[model samples]
Target: MVLASALLATLGLVSPVSAGASKGVELGASDTEGVTTSATPLRGTRGVSSYEGTGVPSDVTAYGAQRVPAGHRIEGYSSPTGDDFGTQSIIGADGRVRVDPTTSFPARATVLITRTVSGVERLHCTGWMFGASLVLTAGHCVFNQSTGWYTGQLRFYPGANGTTYPYGSCTAATLRSNTGWTVDGSPDADYGGASLNCSIGNTTGWYGAYWTTASLNGTSTTIQGYPGDKSQQQWIHSDQVRASNSLRLYYDNDTVGGNSGSSVHTVRADGSSGCSGRCSLAFHAYGVGSGTHNSGPRITESRFNLVIGWR
Candidate 1:
């Protein structure tokens, strides 16, 4: 899959606010609500309908970030081979596979996001339902860091399978992100939430979020999202957490450019909510560069509360 080079906008930085124990920085009251003019608009062409960047798994050469932490050793690094490493595979070569909502837990809760950059250029990203009317995603998906312009008119599709919109779609009424993203341009602050005008969450349900500092060295982490390379179809990858920090978690799941803002969670062993597992981690965003992993903004107690309030 060939991708046209994107025109990156200059990231505008603002005064950073205190973020407490997490590396995430909070924005002032004025900057915390609604889309702002300073946000980098998420970009795409009028004809461009799919994400062209590379996604998870170590060998794929996607446009997405793929840097793991320094010296982080992942378990599946032995005979690296699959889908040409970066050949636009929706699921990664080694362990990724397409998911059927009827068979996967928390799968229907994952939703697809659509928006018009600057109100003309249409683009899409991945997000998860977290409340009756709230969805969570990467801040960059709503506010581009390079462009400094907030996107316009968000449309969400829950349980989206190919051209089928099983759970229907809704337009976002509000887009909120941290001040570090719109003001300071910090990736650590790369999380955003949306309030939907429709009540899809009541039909499909949502996930509860949490954060922790305990070592997740061997914990199962699963990511499901609508990747652009797969024509905006949903896909899934399950892997173990590789490393973490104050504001991020690292894994080797197969993700791509469109998978940004996906929910990276750990499925519970006993299963609940009529599904097999649930998400208990972070929101996936960047692929580690020069590293063998993908990363997401780690959810903190405060961050959890922030999004929960929106829900």
Candidate 2:
């Protein structure tokens, strides 16, 4: 059985293995939680999923599926935008394509994070909705060593394509992160989340997440989120998992600064062993420092349960 939320609150940050990680890790009972797999995410809405077929992709502006969901409410920025926080590295050529409708399954589930920097609200990081009111992201996106939790400084906009906010926006009633990031300052433990003031995820849907002990190399991965350079529009890139360590996964998917906190996920087929549909594998955080590949904190059994408990 899953642990209760109260117990989980004190369990995070026990250790901090991160992207651009130091060494290899071994799987343990906690890696799989005594089971082979688990799917702990609220993934799709019955009538609100947008198109993921085609469009301008990167920055050309494909206005095809700009449909907006009705009834959901809406609701902010900073540094030189994103300076030292979540740093999404771009690999080789810029092959990222703009997500045509931002309203698609994972696209709508994806979010654009902004914070106050140098007196203005600017694009900061990326996030993904995992529950009705939970948005997971890089720990750095919500907290800094010098400043601390950005309680009133951050905002989450789901399916934000340029000037359009199809699903409106949401604010955090509480900001959360593990001690690994807040105390240990570990990048491996860099992932964190927020509990929104609104339950807009009912209309926006969310991304399913799972944890596995098997090698993920060669598994097709897709990174879709708002890149800082894209002027707040959502973009996407696809690549296979290049390497899978115990705590981090590497890939060649192209990304930029603001893509931090984006979900590094795979499209598992229907009725797959552990996860199906747009299932998240890792949390995008750092650039190409762990090697030639970009990386993020992997979703292990503990982290997976941690997020679910947060919800």
Candidate 3:
């Protein structure tokens, strides 16, 4: 099945939020009696309508009550021949993707991840921080056909400069990906987005950093990721990037696994603050690194807006 095909079905799926809900975290506090006493709920354009009669997977239901470890791995990799692509690399001793020296890209958000199966740690993938609590990443990085929601420890890094900054971790209580992602094994789903709330701050991590949202559509973008199977162990660099109609990214640089979910940010030609350049360009979220898809669906903000309510 073609992954992009699922996205075609998504265009008609945009639906508004449940009235007065924000992207991820609820902006206010609640009182006793299960009543929410916060101010006007942070509102946004509604997301896709909820799926009906779709229950959680049996495996997820079985393990939902248990807390898995912070480190886990999942099985399976994207087939390299088709539109989907990734490499085989094991997690390093540093609890990160083993880098390939050859590949490079402008690094933006650093992600922390853990995977589990039958309540056992199985696989892990890094994630990139987006909005205040939003994270962009590959859908497969955290989800699997057998394990369901790969939960353990989720963290983010602003910049990876060895030991200079420590790592940050958060418990991902909620997760969401494109509904079409499961329809086929396409990078189309790679342009996925997620949101996370950090209760514990890690100075060496990304939670403490500031992030601003940009608009989508025809924006100059940059990306950074860890390609464990590439020539570099931990890769970081910048390049002129473009977003495709499929919502996937097409840049001049190279990327691989572990780089999945890497954040794509808007920048100016001179590499200055804000997204506007010499032209009357407005900076905004371009697209997320879902995976390597020459012809796949791209991750759109409308879909992400839906997930924001989930967190």
Candidate 4:
């Protein structure tokens, strides 16, 4: 049985493993020195190059047909009073266990949740960069009294460490979670709940809602995230499943806290069914990490529609 919310409150976010900073790790390459040739970019076969690795496990594989119940929920990692919602886990290219990579889709829709604890500001959870001024993450990450949202200090980095891309960060102006998520930890009701009208202590202004959908299940995808408490830690994993709107992947790899809000992406390999070179099809915005059961959730397009419409 899962731990109760009260029991989980004592289990603050687990610290993730750390990897020294390097703009990004190179994937599927022969050596780190040469001009670096991009691989064929196969959906399920591409290897992650830049991020840290916890050593891949032998169980990683395509998902089976287990569906997450609509009633599944978890206690908020940061919020003592909030309920925890269920999410999907992913494996990074480094073979380390991480959260869903689909969250990185649409590129600019991912964000990093920075907060203040005991007057000391620190990076807390991962989030999605949505719209020109919106970022999405678990509501618990922002509203938890244990971790105060640093309205003025929060930042966002897109494709944070892609080997061929320059890194950038964005300042967050607002934060939002579903009213239900705030009440009973049932964001499942609003799994893709998003709002551009929410705010964080008036410092961050609301942009708009951007949630995910269940359409991504059974589709091939990739997951990226900073795990084990290391900033700049990233990984990529593929060959996934869309189980009840959640994207599930496998990796014996390990992940800890500070990985929340990682992005899950759809693989668009070169010469694949409909893909060409280096292009990702679509990505979900939240990195629900690998759990005790070896699964995670991916936000879907339908959820995004609901968030934008505040449905």
Best by TM-score: 2
Cα error, residue 231 of model 2, in Å, equals 0.7
Supply the global lDDT for candidate 4: 0.35
**Candidate 3: tens digits of C-alpha lDDT, residues 196-284:** 55422112112111122333344444444544342222454434434455345454334444555555444333223212222111111
lDDT of 2 by residue, 157-228 (tens): 778877777766677889998898999998888899999877656566677777777788999999998776
How accurate locally, in lDDT, is each candidate?
A: 0.59, 0.69, 0.36, 0.35
lDDT of 4 by residue, 47-83 (tens): 2211111121122111111122222221123433322
Per-residue lDDT for 127 in model 1? 89
Could you say which candidate leads in lDDT? Answer: 2
The sequence of per-residue lDDT tens digits that candidate 1 reaches over residues 1-311 is 00111111112232222112222122212111321222322222000001111111232112121222322221111222323245332234545577664213366678877765454523368888776577889998888767754535567766666555556566677888988788988888899978777665655556645554456577788888876655445778888888888788888887767788998877553323211236457889887544467888887655654664565
Model 3 CA deviation exceeding 4 Å by range: 1-109, 114-123, 153-165, 183-186, 191-220, 229-234, 268-301, 307-311
| TM-score of predicted structure 3 | 0.47
67 Cα displacement, candidate 3 (Å):
19
Residue 267 of model 3 has an lDDT of 38
Instruction: List per-candidate RMSD values in Å.
Output: 16.3, 10.7, 13.3, 19.7
